[model samples]
Target: MAQEKEIHFTGYEKQISNWTDLIPAERFTLLVLQTLTEVSKDPRGTYITNDRLSNIIGLSPTRISSTITKLKKKGYITVQRVGATGRYIKTRDYNHATLYTYH
Candidate 1:
């Protein structure tokens, strides 16, 4: 079996912990987004799709979309549309994925 990588968020833990209003699913979504951002090495933030998050986090795409909107409304995250002409994931177009960064 492959060993999982250990991730250290340094200061992010303290910041995220203070978001007590977040429910379990929201919190999990944030963690996953954080992980993706950390490993992506993209300063613009992580570009991800709801379907991908659904697959990883075991939530439906609709739920993932709702959670993201909630996070944005709560000032926990910011999103940017990087265009739809570049990149793709197998059968799906990459247009659905947006650049996400946590504040």
Candidate 2:
């Protein structure tokens, strides 16, 4: 069997060095968010749902939601609501995922 390739995150030191105030969960979530942003290779952001984040981080959806809000409040990330058609817009015409841009 072929072994899966391991993935690594770059610039992690810069991400965590200045944020000594972060709790464990917040730090882990921020790292994951930064990794996702880099992997997506999009300047806009990474489009994701709370359920997906929960699965990846092994956190409850509610917990993940609150963590994300905390990150936003700390200016570590910016979130933009995406429409059903995958466009950023003012109106929430339907349920949609959010695009997370890591700072």
Candidate 3:
């Protein structure tokens, strides 16, 4: 059996720090939003669970839930609970014109 590689929290924290400078203040929520968008875009139609999203973004599951709530309130994303599966839908339209020109 192949051993799973462990991710260091320090490295994850550094990565998040790098993104803070790159992503705009208004678009700070893009990390989680973009991840959900990309995951749903996959051909296999893989739906990312809250736990998986938290691990990917280096956030606690509670934080992920809170972020999701905020996104839904702002009409940025939608979540659907279907039977046992939870699906996250990204509703933010990507405006390339105003994307990252500021920074």
Candidate 4:
């Protein structure tokens, strides 16, 4: 029998809590987006799976899926499904968009 490896995450609690109030509607979606952003900032592009995301954020797949759909609908993120793999792309340029300003 093989011993299971333990994953340790330090300081992530604060990051997750900070996003609780900033997300538009669903916190899970925000969590996923924020995690993806952090990963993208790294020199190595990290490919995260839906199961890994759900486990890391302590949310169910159904919840994550629902949030993903909402974020996609709002154009905040892009999800590419190629066969069994799903890729998530966050629109970091949203700040430059004119939707936030009063017209």
Candidate whose TM-score is highest: 2
Q: List per-prediction Cα lDDT, in the order shown.
A: 0.67, 0.66, 0.54, 0.56
Model 3, 1-103: lDDT tens per residue?
A: 9998755433222344443433342134455555556556553333667788777777778877777676667555556655666674564544442433321
Clashing pairs in 2: none
Please give the distance, in angstroms, between residue 89's alpha carbon in candidate 2 and its true position after superposition: 14
Give the lowest summed-lDDT range of ten residues in model 1.
85-94
| Candidate 4 residue spans exceeding 4 A from truth | 1-25, 41-46, 98-103
What stretches of model 2 exceed 4 Å from their correct place? 1-9, 14-18, 84-103
lDDT of 2: 0.66
Residues forming the 10-long window of minimal summed lDDT in candidate 3: 8-17
lDDT of 3 at 12: 26
Residue-by-residue lDDT tens digits, candidate 1, 32-73: 787676567667567788888899999999998899888778
lDDT of 2 by residue, 1-103 (tens): 9998644454563446456778888888887777677667556667777788899999998998899888778777777766763421111111232342235
Quality of model 3 by C-alpha lDDT:
0.54
Deviation in angstroms for 64 in model 3? 0.5
Clashes of each: 0, 0, 0, 0
Evaluated at residue 49, the lDDT of candidate 1 is 89
- The TM-score that candidate 2 achieves is 0.67
Which tens-of-lDDT digit does each residue in 9-64 have in candidate 4?
42233443444334634554554565666668643323567677678777787776
